[model samples]
Target chain A: MSAEVVPLPARAPSLGPILSLTQTSMNAVNQIILDRMQSEIPLIPALAGHLIAGGGKRMRPMLTLAGAAVCGYQGTRHHRLAAAVEFIHTSTLLHDDVVDGSETRRGQSTANIVFGNPAAVLVGDFLFARAFELMVEDGSLRVLKILSSASAIIAQGEVDQLVAQRRIETSEDRYLHIIGSKTAALFAAASRIAAVVAETGDAEEQALDDYGRNLGIAFQLVDDAIDYDSTAAEMGKDKGDDFREGKMTLPVILAYARGSDEERQFWRDAIAGFRTEDEDLAHAVTLIRRHDAIDATRERARHFAERACDALSIFPESKARAAMIDAARFAVSRGY
Target chain B: MSAEVVPLPARAPSLGPILSLTQTSMNAVNQIILDRMQSEIPLIPALAGHLIAGGGKRMRPMLTLAGAAVCGYQGTRHHRLAAAVEFIHTSTLLHDDVVDGSETRRGQSTANIVFGNPAAVLVGDFLFARAFELMVEDGSLRVLKILSSASAIIAQGEVDQLVAQRRIETSEDRYLHIIGSKTAALFAAASRIAAVVAETGDAEEQALDDYGRNLGIAFQLVDDAIDYDSTAAEMGKDKGDDFREGKMTLPVILAYARGSDEERQFWRDAIAGFRTEDEDLAHAVTLIRRHDAIDATRERARHFAERACDALSIFPESKARAAMIDAARFAVSRGY
Candidate 1:
């Protein structure tokens, strides 16, 4: 598994405006998280910091801050909320690596691979618990509800994915449901909670939520596209990692539907056997390209990005709102 | 693993009262959950039912109903709340079995064993997601907050236990923290949510929450005790199951503190190897008994039971309250 680690290009294309906006929104909150994470509980701080500093895009936390900023939340709770979102996201990643038996993440060894499954799972739980503790301090039941519901949905989405594995008959609707629950739900919750915490009305709350949800969908579609397009080194792990795990992402599903009988047989054998041989990988890539799955997926992702921007149109135009829109666009276009 | 199956007794004296209460509660919420579980999504209902019907004490749900009844809740939401609690518990159990690698539960094969690990995990996630859907229907942000926090705490507790395993220096305080988070947190959440939904005062709500927490602690202490004293058949598991799994339960901790040099050596070897031979199990059992660890553990359980009862003193004295107290006592004294 360690042998499969692929180092991606150290630099993504410049996003100066988006980067500056996100950094400004997140800087204060990130510091607070750093301070609060210092704990008497032995080894917790060390483990948490290791994972937090592991070069995550901090997309969930950024969504949270962006939502709050867009809604004119002047208070400090947004920082805590953003931190809580990151903790939940990080915790899930820890458990996910264990479940998927992955060895590398972000060009580094996965926590489960480095610290063992027990440590990874436990640390994930610790982060989750700690996140709750932080939320409790905020004393907003509404925020708590949104975040909790998101956690449940995320867990369910993962489960749906698990059941869908190697299942050729899984519909696009089911696929949407899985991704919505697993990925978009958290993004939605992060944004929506900001509205809830700020006591925004239902209309604005729903709009921000829509923004986050569509952005999340776009993000995942881009991820699926990259899985087929990127080299192992560029992706920070093996090519066809999802395929090796028998995961049926959007591209594969689209390719399978559009491919010839021979292509379908290739999927059957590859997925059923959990095989990621060089030829199988090459064929999958070719099939995705041949069927225009990559282009279709990208188009769908852009549609979501547009939808996200549309959701933000209801809010009075402001720098924060513009930043939030840019963030969505960034999610769709960001390279690994 | 199949060869290790130990059939529990068809009947037990303690189970009579529990079964009666459980059956009554199930009848109330059974159809509701069944109806609500229906989905256009294939495999979800069957999987959800399999999980709900999977044998559990229904302790959390029972606590929810019992808490509401004691608080004089006249509405029907308690039934839904009960089902929600059950779903959360079942989801955790699904994940727990996978994490623990347990083959048997309630004298039957575990979901992970029967359905495979991936299915068990995913189905667990489904139940958790279903739980959120149910929670949103209540529209009480408080209930969502409680359940979500409980979920996070539960996950954290499991992680704490994982990290603490084989570390002989683990404190009783830490043990309490782990069990309270893993087990009592949800129990407390169930009852607290009942009080919240019933629109009770802070005092009564705190009382019920404390009651649930102490009861949960006592329940887990008894479970730990039985792991040492009860047979595989009696306990619905192999004797020394915890010891075999390298779990550092209260009995093992107490015994280790009191054991001779040789006995300590036995524990060190058992945890390291992940099993204890029959003779080693016998020796460990003898040391636990001789050191009065069983009685000490029982005493601790009783203390918590008393604390649970004490918390209910402020509640209007009624049959429901009496039953709640009896339930706590039964938790510790049932097998004895």
Candidate 2:
């Protein structure tokens, strides 16, 4: 009992490396985003600018730039493509707010809340069309194919998620499938397009896609986990949104599987939207913690993050590769 | 003394010629539409099919087919392109229903009402993405650019219309501009692409574009006129919707401009949404009729329809050309 207990100390993973690696190109991408979002209709730019200027991590665009760097690409083509990827992401976010009736995003008023749902929906359409316009201007049918297919997949994934909402029995596999399409498909496309612009052959393209896809899973899992982790810092989104919305995320899946009969009954009622009060959310967080569901979700995320890092082993070691690896680690480690 | 009015009756313009001209190829386009709309997600097809099979006239796709016939296109490329055009049109219709919160369309419950706004919005996104996927499969960047640009213009026009809603001072020029962007842009693109597939010269492309654009304006003006024309047959939509929603259509613009001081006050309150009862709509309709605004709107539509027919003067006389001119006349003559 008296034996010394030592806590293992490790430096926390950081996005700083990846951020620095892609800084200049990210600026160019940002410029393209700003330039392309403009229209003769003032409302289009006003509503779009609110979210565009809101502080997002710009993770998807960063992946494009970083993938281009890892591929030893010297062209400036990725800049516009990266902008297109961001536009696609932003469009989905706007629509998501309308679907969810969300009030806050990025710790600020959502576009749907700031500009009414009608404006939000229309501007989302404008941005999505603009994204395709950018891809067309780049004259890459290949990129267009990748992004358009991904867009369809993302929409299907959202509809599937809507169908699964408020159902307590959703499996972890189904949740993974939903996120794979809704979140990871675009990530994979974003990274793969960089490889295409760099003229990297199939192997490298596949490698980057694998990397981005796995990292996207890890990121989404952690996001779900953080929603139920009461001890975590506030995220850009409102906390407990998934719980209130009855989204069957991984932590809820794990907690439901591990809970006692009474706890299971509670989950069923809560997820069916019968229990949305503060106490219900608190009980949910407590039950999730008691069953170690948050830790389990983080464990799953760590596995994917490791796979994501190993995906780059096909390429030679470089600063870009190292930074990308670090970014994957950060994806799993954030809000811990 | 009595005036004997001999009603001049030319054979009422019919879509018969155009319909027969494109019937065979339209079947091919229909097959493509059915084949492409399917997905493993059952709801996508169920919701999409409800509207796709909901007895729409397939006007936009027909335009594509008719334009192809007019250009004497020998190949089947226009079939797939026509399906793509229909998908774009269907996607916009779905979104429009959601934006307008419409309960009925085509004499049936709207997709938004049956499937919920979330499903309608997501399915709309899916169809829009599918439209681009089709374009990508065709491997034509020029067509992609045309459609994408048109899509953006449509979105902007919708936003502008939303801004103009409930504003009594909206001008006829503004209304025309909005319709030009929202409705006519797609028609112009649908027609122009046929020329592209035919490898016709720039002049031919411009002529077809002019034909479709003017025809679309005529079609929409008639649509607006029909909304307030009580003597006309019930349309495939809820009558008085424009009045209830305070949309600034041409009839409303002309009526607002021509109303007496007292009548103007009634319009001011009605357009501001303070007056939505049945009697209020009745009074509004009476004012429009008293001012002959419905007839004025139809007269405007006729001018555009004549321009549409004249646009075909450059082409040699043929079955297709004659059918297209009749189609223009039909655009103005419907619901007279």
Candidate 3:
């Protein structure tokens, strides 16, 4: 059967005001990252330029800028902080592609595929180092402490996912733990750094940090859900690619737990056995749908989105704060 | 002619003192590392324990301790600093093995090979994160600054080596540049941190920093030299493994440059063509040896060693300082 391709909506719900606010905040951060990424090593500068120019969603950086703005940060260091956040994210992507042996990302050839694994790995390291250098320039040991911890958490999450792949008993808690480490840790760090940078303490800092973490969790859950719901064309990669790589994301984890004995056996064979036949793909998708794993996963995402929005209650009502809440909602509602 | 297996001498001129000193320093550092590598995550503690307990050469950590001692550091933080240094090195090895797709390290199956790549990668990150956490406890921005920078340089070096692997004209300058970033940067950083932790200023700091850098370069030169000299049995891997991987270490780079046009053509085909047969290995080795690549490489190693010893002149002559000097010389001459 031919799969239906769902185009990303040109207009996200009420995105006009939100985009303008996000863009204004993000522009300052983006400019700083570009400027600071310069290096004497030709390759370092070249690769940095390529990555900065690559047009990532800038989700984490935007979160950082928005978080600081909501807390009334008038200082310029937020821009540097945001850029450091993006560099960390980008560096991870470079290394991630190498680890996964992936050849493409976001419909473009992966850096590893284009630049080769070693270039991707080393360049990733360059970005990471550059990020630290940028952070040090800000001279906030508190900020440094937060970011270093976040980086470690992010690495741990990726490692957890690596070890847990294709294991039948991977629980929802395990899934949450992995996603929290890999994805939410950085998001939380980015926003928290904004708070630390701005010297906004107590309830406001905690609120903003919670907001970032929840939003990140919601974002990743949505991503995992989409992997199951979307096709190769819609997702810009093959359907069940995660399964092919022996990854058991949220939907699969849920389905495996809820499926019949035969269905459970199928997952064991299909994922663990490395079965890539079309029949296996069709069957796996059917089982996921039959188990209503998609809806269940979406509910989890919405829960996190709501929690993210609720975290903004401590912030005095402002356009920037409101936009952040909207973005959290929009993250869950985007591909619906 | 049957190849003669030249055993590492039981009592080489410098090995006895060097080994004894390194052993003493390493034992202290190892104790500190073991005591501190704890975490809330049971997996983290377990995995870290496994890795630290796996008995690496601890060359990098020893460098940090020796650097501190030679610089006349009496502080206890050097122990943590040494452990931090080792953790970073160990973490990199875990990731490096995964990236290189190798299965053995230090004459044992690699963490990636034994535990699988995901575990190895994540555990490596765990160690990295743990290192930062440990460093933060020291409350020395100088150490953090040096370490963070070293981390970045090391990653960049790995990337540079990745790109440099297949290119035939990868210059000696480029080789040094890559090694400096990848290997020597950490060595330099480890020693520099030791100096900082000791509160040594200016000349002494620069001396130890230079000592670390030169020693690292010498160490790598010996490593590259040995890649051509050792075998699968002796090295615990195949001879020409680097050649097989299309890596152009110093010997191959020199041989290719110095060989006859026909010999150069042979190398070009062997490297570029992905040739990995026994005959290809034999020819590559023969060409490299016939061209005096080994001798030339050894000379380069000696130069760096001499430079390392020269860097120690700033310090008052002492047993610890003498040992460090001997270690530099031993880095070059021990195997030869």
- Report, in order, each candidate's fnat: 0.32, 0.75, 0.56
Ranking by TM-score: 2, 3, 1
Candidates in descending DockQ order: 2, 3, 1
Error of 3 at B148 (Å): 2.0
What lDDT score goes with residue B21 in model 3?
60
lDDT of 2 by residue, A1-336 (tens): 699978898878899999999999999899999999999999998999999999988999999999999999999999999998999999999999999999999799999988899999999999999999999999999999999999999999998998899999899999999999889999899989988999989999999999999999999999999998888888888999999999999999999999999999999999999999999999999999999999999999999999989999988999999999999998988996
lDDT of 1 at A9: 68
Report the number of backbone clashes for model 3.
Answer: 2
Worst 10 residues of 3 chain A by lDDT: A230-239
In terms of DockQ, which candidate is stronger, 1 or 2?
A: 2
Better of 1 and 2 by lDDT: 2
lDDT of 2 by residue, B1-336 (tens): 899999888788899999999999999999999999998789999999999999999999898899888888889998998999999999899999999999999899999999999999999999999999999998889999989999999999999999999999899999999999999999999998999888888998999999999999999999999999999987899999999999999998999899889998999999999999999989989999999999999999999999989998888899999999999998898885
Models 1 onward score TM values of 0.85, 0.97, 0.89
- Candidate 2: docking tier: high
**Tens-digit lDDT track of model 3 for A92-164:** 8877777787866766677777766656666776677678778877777888888888988887788678767
Among residues 3 or more apart in sequence or in different chains, the pairs in candidate 3 whose N, CA or C atoms overlap within 3 Å are A122-B159, B232-B237
- Highest-scoring model, lDDT: 2
Task: For each candidate, report its DockQ versus the true two-chain complex.
Answer: 0.28, 0.81, 0.40
Candidate 3 global TM-score:
0.89
Q: In candidate 3, what are the lDDT values of residues B178-259, reduced to their tens digit?
A: 8888889888888888788888887777888898899899888878888887531265444566887788789989999998
